[model samples]
Target chain A: MESGQHMLRTGRRGTLFEFSMALRDLVTSYHRRGLAWSLAWHDVVSRYRGSILGPFWITISMGLMVLGIGLLYAKLFGISVAEFMPYVAMGIVFFGLMAGTINEGCDTFVQASSMLSQTSLPMFTFIWRTVLRNLINLAHHAVIIVAVIIFFGLWRVMDVLPALGGLLLTIVNLAWIAMLAAIASARFRDIPQFVMSVMQFAIFMTPVFWKPDAFPDRHAFLTLNPFYHMLTTIRAPLLGQEADGLSYIILAIMAVLGWALTFSVFAITRRRIVHFL
Target chain B: MTDVSIKVTDLTLRFPVYGVDAKSLKKNLARVTVGGRLGASTTGATEVTALSHLNLNLRAGDRLGLIGHNGSGKTTLLRALSGAYEPDEGQIEVRGRIAALLDLSLGIDPSATGVDNIRLRGRIAGMSSKEIEDKMDEIAEFSGLGPFLAMPMKTYSAGMQARLAFAVATAVEADVLLMDEWISVGDADFQKLAHRRLLNLVERAGILVLSSHDAGLLRLYCNKVMRLEGGVASEVKDIRRLDELLAAA
Candidate 1:
């Protein structure tokens, strides 16, 4: 607690040096084990208290959505049932994880305004809870992703390793998004709405329903869209193809930049947080 | 002064409220349309001081009552003492944790069961889950909301809700207990239990600062009284002076 106070006081000076040190301390303190898991479990059980097969409903709905969309999009795109089915199914799973993470990410602190405003604890707990809930949702939906891939004969020796990589990258991406959005949304209050509008445009701009190769001339724009790269990183690798190092580097840079910005903002504005709340 | 366990020196806190600065609608419109300054040579926006150069000291076993009109900085001082708000211009040093009953209703979650909310509030009070579990039966009995303990907190009546919050909050053994007003837990049998519980809790706390306008109650319970007016503490030079002032009035 003394160290926590020191970090806060030094943070108030707003020096870049103090800011980075505080950020390091913040990340290190987040590793205090089991706190996040307990809170997240609390969030899950309390959210669906009365319902039977509560979280299983997540899996059932997702499976039905993929099945319905896979058949419809396969016919609409005039592609073979065999090839198109895998693509659409994988796309829905991958896109769901990406969009759900960012959408929920922006509201992480705002939604937890109730908890944070009352008790003075580590801010990471709120962010971690958001990340954990999404991860839980992913786990439920992953059953669908797995069932579809196995049914379509997409599972292979190399597929296992790439699937792990995809999961890891997705987690890392969501973590970064949560940290960034919490700080931004806490400050602006309008950033969540702005993010929602931007996501609407990003849905069409990214190659979710369509293939990346659909835009032959606008290759640069496709590459610039981080989601395009994230999807490619996860989906391509799972399909037993080479993952893009360029996209990985791009995402790595974005993650670092995002954290840096969040750290500075959080350090500068932490005391003001209660006032806003 | 020798027994002083908490000290506040020249404390000042300024809040910058964000919005148009004008005090009136007509003035705001004039400033917006004509680009005219509302005040003589400066913009209408300025700092509204919530606390200004206030100084006080308190000792262990002191029960102090604060009395003030609305906007008189009673809540701000409480917030500052509890470390909720940082003072801009001076120092406040208290030896132990300050438990403030500023807003009882805000800490509770409507969606959670009474039992669950009790656990959550326990955690907020720095009690580990294991500690809360150990006291679970005691807290349940204290709340007096039998069978409905398993129901959502929103289902409880206002009095029942206050019982749950008060039960959980008092479960913590605090160093200093700050109360804004007297919280009455309103059933006859439970009210007696609550009174005994509150008296015991207040006795255990080393320092108690209560803010209320009821002078007779303050004289009965508090050892000292401090008057605040226009964001400043009234200058009572000594205990004799304070008593003289209170007696003369």
Candidate 2:
């Protein structure tokens, strides 16, 4: 129905207006929570449709990695398996979530090019769908972390509350990261490949397979790595160790900076994105 | 009375071909360091102007037809109206809820069942879950794929998929309806039913913008028509006169 109101307008818009519009699109997508949740579930279910193990395959693979790496590394480092397995499990689980999210985030817009052209939904919807799908995948792999903690008798009720808080913060951080990566990768086709290679290299560089204590002389280098801070925030709490105040400070700074950067990029490129696709 | 209108003023759209220049980081960095002119020439970064300063207007009860040859920006103009492509210059103001059927099966998921695809495609068509749920029975009945609705969409034959997609796409009521081409569905019987349904939808819509190469179909459905060539549009005042011109050509 027409009420002398313009429902859609395409032309020059001020920077602030464009930014607010992009933000409004995000809010609208959130309000349509049903669509996002349904799509996310659809992604996970269809991906593992015919497999007997379904999502459990991720849990099994991760479980084996933790067990195998934990035994060899604990012995190699002169630590008990019980003490090290939980650390390895939590580290790998959280790292998998981080790296997997970034890896998939790059394809969020490119893969949805068809749907985007076919429909006029908010750009944020695709980003949220990617994040939700990765979150679901993380939930599947989390089964291994819980099992390892229980088996090693490393469960601490007091640590659970903070660990959940840290996990929430990490998820929030990754949401911004995903948005930034999705937009950049949409414009430059090779960004996804670059991100994938960087992530593969990051796994060895980050403390996923080893502990920070093992590299005392290179402690400063570890402190400078944002991935290290992201992992530590969730890993320390899960291991029943207190995360240093510096990690929280770094995370808060990163979140603020990341959102600012992502918002600017999204606002500038929101309209031009359709052309790129 | 519900009113629908679309006003486009000097709309233009250009697509950038990100060739060797911007497709890769290495090439882009080298270009930035070495300067733009040399890099641009070597990499062949060029822009394709799909739509020029084209202007048009439509109001309620208007069934406007677009006739154009291939790559003549007919699809580009329709896409611009649907808000799928943003214009590089000028302005477009659209009033009313729009349902664009650019491609019949654009959003259908093969892994999803026929029933599930109805919901997915409905949402993609800008319908709320409740709206889709309310219309589900009618769409299902119209599709005539009762038992097959439970099967995956990939299992459906091409005609079956087309029928399902057409049923869902036209089920929703909108003030503005945009279509790239006339969609024909299923066997002879279903085609008749689909034809009737399409007529009803076009009649109900406050505005309709359809693009096709068929001149006869345009004369039947549209009172006014415009022909596009090389990103420019010119009105064809008399359908008979245009037909004569086409016959001569």
Please give, for residues B1-249, the per-residue lDDT of candidate 2 as tens digits. Answer: 255788998887786776654667776677778777563365444788887888888888777888778998898888888776767788777887777888876867798899989998887776788999999999999998999999999999878887898888878777777888855446987878876876786667577788888776777667667778778877544555566535442
Q: Across residues A226-260, which tens digit of lDDT does each residue of candidate 1 receive?
A: 78777777777666666677777777777778777
lDDT of 1 at B208: 73
Count steric clashes of candidate 2.
0
Model 1 collision count: 0
Clashing residue pairs in candidate 2 are none
Instruction: Output per-candidate TM-scores for chain A, rounded to 2 decimals.
Output: 0.86, 0.94
Best model number under lDDT: 2
- The C-alpha RMSD in Å for every predicted model, in order, reads 5.2, 2.8
Candidate 2, residue A147: how far the Cα is off, in Å: 1.6
Q: What's the residue-level lDDT of B201 in candidate 2?
A: 65
DockQ of each: 0.18, 0.53
Per-residue lDDT value at B197 in model 1: 76
